[model samples]
Target: MACNKSFSSNYFLLTPEEVGFFDLIHILFSTTKFEEGIKFLDMSKFVSKPLSELGSGIEVALNLIPSNRNVFVFMLNFLRGRAVKPDKTSATFLSFIGLIDKRVELDGSIKHGDANYHAALSAMASKASYENSACIETIVKNHWKMKFLGFYDFWNDYQGKATTQAFLLRDKTCDQDTIVVAFRGTEPFDADAWCTDFDFSWYELYGAGKIHGGFMKALGLHKNDGWPKEEVKQDGKPPRPRAYYAIRDMLNKLLRQNDESRYIVTGHSFGGALAILFPAILAMHDEAWLLERLQGVYTFGQPRVGDEKFGEFMEKQLKEHRVPYFRIVYGNDMVPRLPFDDNALMYKHFGTCLYYNRHYEVKVVEEEPYRNYFSSLGAIPKMINAFWELIRSFTISYAKGPGYKEGWLLRIFRIIGLVIPGAPAHSTQDYVNATRLGSSDVFVPPKDI
Candidate 1:
């Protein structure tokens, strides 16, 4: 694909779809570069060397597993029944992650005035974002006693389908009424979503630095045109509405209706990345009205989205807007530790990191201990922590109460952690636990946005 005039000139994008089995093998030996192996990387100012090569390698590796068509078909046939059934919310392999902690009501201990109240609320909303519209509506309206705004599945310009999902809810108490927008994260059975996570493509904005290209596409990045302040009109049939534009319009209407209404964006995993990026785009467009009304941003197990420069830009934007940005990481959860914060990749995490250990101990840090997950020295400790977590699952209920109990499914997942240490730690259950059980002091709420 040729570079569009409006698109960023400096970018490195990889398309795993173009890689054949032989071409996948060619990634390892980069000496004789195969021009047709990966398409998109040949664009002007973007080469298929080293960085894009590494990204292509990662994408190909993921494609060989459940992220491919064959595995997806097998998984769907095996898990399809779960999706159709009323009891099961999703057909994804990790659907059981949401089932581990089924508690819908906010913790009674965390009162409305408590510092952790919004964090706890946001965590539950993030978890609920993974479920279907029916489940979300029931939980919000009946259990939480909140107003269900709407659930949306938005289009991804690059992927050519509606792959992004999010829902909005309004929680009004006697003291305040806040709007919560929760984005759905990667699903295990979704090849497209997995491809998105594995794709390390990036686009460098004029001043914002380099942002993840896959995420930008997922969050309404137009193919030909970069982010124009206003949505571009499509000729012939109107294209599907994107997540950014669509959500922005919805927020404008909602905030206009009530002068006091404020909104916060949140999500888990891939959703978390989108949650933080939502406001960055708002800041880019200089949406003073929405930025002023943006209460805070809370992300759980969010992956690194940009370089150090991008991080600095985001820090300035968030600080100038007076937005409280909280990045929650539970133990060695692997998602937050990527895409590697090394010289080669240059991805970094900024903002306050509320790091929670296995015992739900909270530590406010600039970044998590192990910024990269692939360290040889850290491997043993991560495994030890994983083993301890498995043991803790059985006895956590006795210590914390019945609400903290782990189910058989979660135990099975914990067992898998033995093989892949940080995998189980990325679950929504632990994040929910962190918000509810962890200290409230970590939350730095400014006087007002």
Candidate 2:
């Protein structure tokens, strides 16, 4: 009933054919004819098809079916089939329907003013520190109704030495189920994490601007997955970055296991950068359902990863899919501003920024033409500042490195009251603290910084 009201309000946004397709999906699901639904979709039509073509097909489907409340109700039942536990195929069909529902809501003109969404996201970001399995289990079991499905500890190295982690969570109690893949941020005093941060060489991606070579390699994308030569070359493109490939594999496996669940990808700092990247790569997949199921990406203090070209490409892709990327910034967190914004260097940030200033107030920055002021500075001054920042980053990295005798870096900072302006503003705790202050304390950004 609520969805119907929402859909009715935004009916203008939906073409006749889209409405028809929604009706068709609802009928097929209500009658338990999922196989026919899949056949009607015709996966071949999606592969290699651009968004316009895919959209056209949806239009045709809508034209053929009668749009009504039954369609919406059936679609909701399919998405919230918590009691049914449908087979994988049925699940996939239902998930596709669920994705369509989400896309409709997201693309609609209604304002998403729910504070609970932001609060829940902040809570998730706060959980980034639970790297140990037991701690993760405790948090999931005690704090929310969600179940801890599993944790993935992946290596950026080929030999499986240096590792980064992500965990999966599922909530089945709600009307619409959800699956979250949350990546952990840099450990307070771990050298390996710092090493991953420092290794920022630019690496070229096919059809996208150059990304941080270190992060790319750290995700193990350059390495082969032992697929047969022909299988590996099936896409006719060069090998995808190892991290992207690995994440895709894991996500595909999870989706199969939990077919009706919507996905939310998130992380903090280094992990936040990966969260932004994971969805960008996922958008390239031939499976239309995968992109549809993506709910949102929320990151805290993510660094600039690619150049302007990459940013442009991602902005277009994400906008087309009606996906929202919230890059939450706390104070003057330096990570969001780095790898240097120099156009010549090719590093840029994608998505709308929700900036929280020192007073823990918030403001939303829509995407615009970005100019890297650092590159615009006087030659001598720019060089001096760059050199100084480089040294400072290294020193901070080493202090946070595994070799540091300190138990944890954040604890040390708290004890000493050591608060620097930039990177220190980059912590997940700071983000959580700011968000806890609530929307009533929201701050508008001053016209002049």
lDDT to native, each model: 0.80, 0.51
In model 2, where is the ten-residue run with the lowest total lDDT?
7-16
Q: Could you tell me the C-alpha RMSD of candidate 2 in Å?
A: 23.4
lDDT of 2 by residue, 346-392 (tens): 46787677777554557777531223323233335434433443343
> Best by TM-score, which number?
1
lDDT of 1 at 250: 97
Q: How displaced is residue 241 in candidate 1, in Å?
A: 1.3
Q: Model 2: runs farther than 4 Å from truth?
A: 1-115, 122-126, 158-162, 224-247, 256-260, 366-419, 440-449
Tens-digit lDDT string for candidate 1 (151-228)? 999998776678899999998977787999999998655656766776667788988988987788899998888898
lDDT of candidate 2?
A: 0.51
Q: How far out, in Å, is residue 336 in model 1?
A: 0.6
